[model samples]
Target: MSARTFLRIAVSNTLVKNIARYVMMMLLALLLFGIILLATGKDPFQSYRDMFGATFGSAYGFSEVLVAMIPMLITALAVALPSRVGLINVGGEGQLYIGAAFATWGALTFKDQPAWVLLPLMALLGMIGGALWAFIPGYLKSIGLVNETITTLLMNSIAPKIVGFLIFGFWHSPMDTVKTENFVSAARLPTFFNTRVHLGFVIALVLLALFWIIMKYTRWGLEMRAIGGNPQAARRNGIPLKGYLIVIMCLGGAIAGLAGMSHVSGFYGVLILNFSMGLGFMGFLICWLAGGDPIGIFLMSFVVAIITTGGNFLQLTQGLPYAVINILLALALFVVLASPKFFEGKKA
Candidate 1:
């Protein structure tokens, strides 16, 4: 092809356009955050250098980023699946907590079982816990009794408290009142590369692949998409809209539960009081930014993981508050939200 034709072809490629948009949005977010740092009399250049250096410049640092990414990837999928059917599942937080709680219970109960049996049992318990918690809102939304968003959000607050109650009153370790005893080896997920990275990483990747495959090729996925695009039309054509909404929400919760299970079993090795630190909400933000695309979720989750993992470097080396990471993330999200306009302007 001629040079001009090649250039036009590259620009017209959807993947290329999306990549360009994402890169520009990221740069804009970084630039805005740098200005904020400069306004606060900090050396933004040094801070930026430190951020990348601490997270992406070392093998251990990169591994830690992967560690941070696992739960966010899974939880983001939790939100993404429901969004496919036009269901807003804001209960990932609750689902995660409940899942952890259930997994913890299994760990304690099956302490003497072999790894083969115990690990799967714990994972199942976690999914059941999360799915059960999600069902309340799903059922309500299906019946038109309450909006899923409101019920799920409200349940998020309640779920943690229930977990707290369980821990304080029943499951506390003998030494640590705020956490359970360490999980037995049988109950823990296996790790690889002598790092904290565990089976959960593989699970996340498989889930992402499955998500992509199902959405691209499955009849159920087609109907779900139709429902999302036009619920009334879908219903008229015989799609079971209410059933899909309920089932999909539960599936999302199950995935979020797996995230919780991996967290407690593979990462923490014990359920600590209030250990989540807004992972569900962070996943929600990631899902929103990625527009429910599996590939987008993976990439955006990594970016978020970098920001979160680098937060400690900023606090210790740059003397910036840890909360600075949240501000940076917020700026990135805002930039993404405004990116459609940016693209529109480019077209104009």
Candidate 2:
């Protein structure tokens, strides 16, 4: 085949594979919902229908779901980039928090600056802070002294404590609550409406476009994809493995940092204990489930977000346990895990 033909074929194959994977995921979700109904002795069809309808039935619910998806898009990008370069970035939570804390600091300290300067500065500093935060593990891995996962996870533990110290020791807002500090007006992001949605969603969308383009068209992306397919072969083919790893780690940190800014500047507008919470891990889950497909990231993030929103709705309206909704999602993940080869055989 000609090079153009090969490229077309590859793209065609990828589209088919992605579609098959999503179909299997949906089928698995149905099966699990049925199993849940059987186990709980509840009407599975009704429960499933209510759960799904709760996510999509109202404008408020739909908006809430999309708002929740914003962070995952950012974090998924962070995880997916490093993932493509064959590196695991477990430090996204830590990187995100630290970036938020520092961005909050910058926003407060530079209160006199205009938005044009302050916004870019905060984002840049956030990116730098997160990159440095993840760099330790990346450096250690590059030099052959330690595994990145352990080090990255350790950093995750360390991040909240550092934030705690800042809240208690310094940077504490005058509010009676000692647990979190509020950010100033210039520090917080402007919302799209009276709703909690922020410009960060747009930021994430732009990032999705950028990442997709990079992965699809760039030489660096080609190298990363080749390396991800098989590092040993990539190394043999003259890809600088360590350099790519460092790049991946740093970019991953920047992506996480962007997520951090979204929280501080958009959601909470404060430095709080474990503020980032499960978002980073959630992003990784999206990345894993989507296999670095940008469009898939966009769709699956919203789907997961809808489930989360619906879970909250169930809690508020039906007195359903939050744990039950989580269990449903977990079951879905398990189903996907149990059938890795389910999507591989699709030819179209």
Candidate 3:
């Protein structure tokens, strides 16, 4: 092909188009958010510079960004997996909470165990806890008794309360009424190179890779994609739709539980009451923005993590409210929603 033709062909490629669309959405979102900043009498350019510089200026700042990203990466997968089968799992928060609770129980009960023994046991317990919590909603959905979205969303509210009760009544530390004691060295996820970034970052990346592989190559992936495309058609093909529904939802929960486990074990080293600051919801937003693409999930999660870390910097440096980040995120989401066709490549 001629050079010009090659360039046009490359630009027209599906992957290239999707990437370009995401870039456009982000630019548009930033522009809109900048206007909002201007309207509020803030220096938008300076604010942008400060945010990016604070996040990228030092190795420590960048490591913190990764620390923030790990949870969202895992949680976004929690939402993304169920989505592949036409299931909407909005309870990643609850799943994460229940998972952490389970891991905490294991960590306390087996506090003296060696790292090799305790870590895997805690991870298994965390997965089981999240899966069980997710199962209630999954079962309800499978039998057509209720929608997964509503059940999962309602459960998100319940999970934290249950954690709160456990903390106050059974797991509280001597120094705090609303948090558990710090976990032993065995229970804590190993950190990297003296930075806050933990093993969860590796775990999240592995799960994301696994997700891509399963969805792209496996028979189950094929079936799930069929179901998502047309449920009635998939059912007619003897795909065992109900079983997939229940299993996949539970699996998604298991992943979310891992996120919870990582947060406590790696990030906090203690279970605190209401520790999650809408992580599940944020994951949901990332999944929506990425439209269930693995690469998109990673990119969007990183973008969000940068924004989140920058929000902290903005508060200290520019005297802006941390809540401003939410407004930016909302604008981005709105832009994506309003221009769905752009991402969908509808015209092409």
Q: Which portions of model 2 show Cα errors greater than 4 Å?
A: 1-24, 27-50, 177-179, 229-239, 342-348
Q: What C-alpha root-mean-square deviation, in Å, does candidate 3 show against the real structure?
A: 3.7
Cα lDDT tens digits, model 2, 217-247, are 8898898888888888998999998887877
**Per-residue alpha-carbon lDDT of candidate 1 for residues 1-348, written as tens digits (9 for 90 to 100):** 489986885578776777888889889989999999999999989998999999889988899999999999999999999998888888899999999999999999979999999999999999999999999999999999999999999999999899999999999999988999999988999998888999999999999999988987899889988988888999999999889889998999999999999999999999999999899998898887788888788889998888888888999998877988898888888888876443232110
Give residue 228's lDDT in candidate 2 (0 to 100): 81
Q: What lDDT score goes with residue 188 in model 1?
A: 90
Reference-based TM-score of each model: 0.93, 0.86, 0.92
- Model 3 clash count equals 0
Among all windows of 10 consecutive residues in model 1, the one with the lowest summed lDDT is: 339-348
Whole-model lDDT values for every prediction: 0.90, 0.79, 0.90
Question: How far does residue 113 in candidate 2 sit from its true spot (Å)?
Answer: 2.5
Q: Can you tell me which runs of candidate 1 are displaced by over 4 Å?
A: 1-12, 340-348
> lDDT per residue, candidate 3, 177-209, as tens digits?
999999999999999999999999999999999
**Could you tell me which 10 consecutive residues in candidate 3 have the lowest summed lDDT?**
339-348
What local lDDT does model 1 show for residue 2?
81
Looking at model 2, residue 105 earns an lDDT score of 77
Deviation of model 1 at 295, angstroms: 0.6
